[model samples]
Target: MTPASLVRRSETWNFDIDAYTNPYTPPSPLHRFPPWLSRFLGYRKEQKEDVGNVLGAVWSCVGTVLGLAVIAAVFNNTASIRAHNPPALIASFGASAVLEYNAIRSPLGQPRNALLGHTISAIVGVAITKLFQLSPHFESVKWVAGAVSCGTASALMLLTGTVHPPGGASAVLAATSPEIMAMGWYFVGLVVWGTTLMLGVGLGVNNVQRRFPLYWWTPVDLRELQRRRRRDGRADVENDVQPEKIVDVVREGEEKVSLGGIRIEAWGVEVPEDLVLSKEEAMLLEVLRERLRKRGDDGVLERVPSSRPSTDCTMVLSRSGRSGSDTEVLYSVT
Candidate 1:
């Protein structure tokens, strides 16, 4: 005679066991830490700030201000421009300006994308608005028309290799704004002109320190460059100013050359009698040992203490007997 509880337990339905107990299930972060604490901490892996960071931000601000000012001046001073076009100072220009000046290296920030994307999106938006004019009975058709126009413009941007995200806003503006929609081709001219102004400003500002619009139309292939470097045996990895790897290898009996905080301890090789290495392991060990010997022989290896103050400095050795005792050679990373 089975009890009611036992019978009910046995009768319980079994769902997909694999789904609940999946071996490939990714670990959840919820269990690791409290969401509130994590949120408070924010990003853990932030990049270290450099000298150019503040200057770059200032430069970006200046470019945006100048670009917007030019557009505003054009629209405010010229009545004919305002009659046919939406206000030159639109919301999209802010996003465009950021990419143009700050993230000038991105493909979307290129002059071709900025100009073509806005122009095409404007045309698409106007076309969609005109299509909606035919079906005036549908009260909510305008919203749908705007969304569709933006979507189509995005697709067109991708197809044409001019995917400027801000251009979608331009499309939305064209479809939603009655004033701009009424003007037809004149609206496109406004977008082009505004974008052109920003592009010119971006070129001038970015070129001051960094190369903007690395190419006129073609997107720079960073991956291709990396691949070429790899193929070339790391020959041209460094440009005009190559980064120095301050290795501090400790020799058996040598004067320590200190260079600020940068350090790399000497790698010692010791094969124990009980130790066993495979063919590959033995070969690697041999190569490593040879490298160690070569580096040791060079006498360039020295320990740099972590407590040392600055990153850049000059060490002058006043040789008493040497004729050119005061001859100072500068070794700057930049």
Candidate 2:
């Protein structure tokens, strides 16, 4: 009765007899295919490398190389004292370099985060190891200490607004790695030194590319803010004059617009006293003049004597008849 009942229950559970006897399955035909061909044909979840990342890749490599070289040089040159171990470079520093160099635009990649997060994590890790007296022989003790250290490091970094993801790895290294554990609190100092070196490289390399640390502690640009405010103020005053009608003149590498005697200027483009507009810009100006002419009861486009003898593109346009009166408006579009 027991055997019969067991058999019935096993059948009810749908246990596979084949799985128990022979679980192994023959490899698929695809296994015989060339790897390159498979890669070309197979569906992949990962996206192709962005062409834009070429510059980033080059800079990251340079920064990583430079930063690590400096650290290695220091490590080699420094004399160690008896009974005290100088900080050896840790694996986490490699990860830190990736963020600091490769992903410099990230908040966690900033100098403050890289330095503080690693230092805090290393300290926490060392503290946990010492507090627990975690022995390598006892796997459970090591695991507990490592886990606690990692958790504390993460919490501290997050609270301090210095959440560098690699700091967790640093905690794990400090708590679990034999080399780091033996070095004791010396690991913290090492982390600081390494971080500083890497950060210096990152700053230099990233700035050279005209991008990096995208923000300091804050993303606010005070200069940009002030400029915006001033622009807004100017716009408010010109609001009655139809700010949209003010044509933005692009001349070579300058941006300037003159409307109602208010000159709006921006970087990378300047309007010279005698600027020659591009074909597209000239067409746009004509379109604007046409629109104004359509609105006017009487309008005529006439060339006038230029104050600058070299400038022949000066054109004067007069539109009359809002109230049956004539008004002369001087607009120079080159």
Best-performing candidate as measured by lDDT: 2
- Mind sharing the TM-score for model 1? 0.50
1-334, model 1: which lDDT tens digit per residue?
Answer: 5698788887875544323333333332322567443322221223233327788888888888888888788877788886665555777888888888788767888887889888899889888888887896534778888899999999888877778999999898887776777787688878888898788777666655455665555533444644654756533322221112221223333323222332223332233223333333433433444454467678756543433322222222122335867543222221
Residues 165-199 of candidate 2: C-alpha lDDT, one tens digit per residue: 99999999887888778889888888887788777
Best by TM-score: 1
lDDT of each: 0.62, 0.63
How close is every model to the real structure, measured as TM-score?
Answer: 0.50, 0.48
Error of 2 at 96 (Å): 0.6
Candidate 2 local Cα displacement, residue 262, angstroms? 34
RMSD of 1: 22.6
Tell me the RMSD of model 2 versus the true structure.
22.5
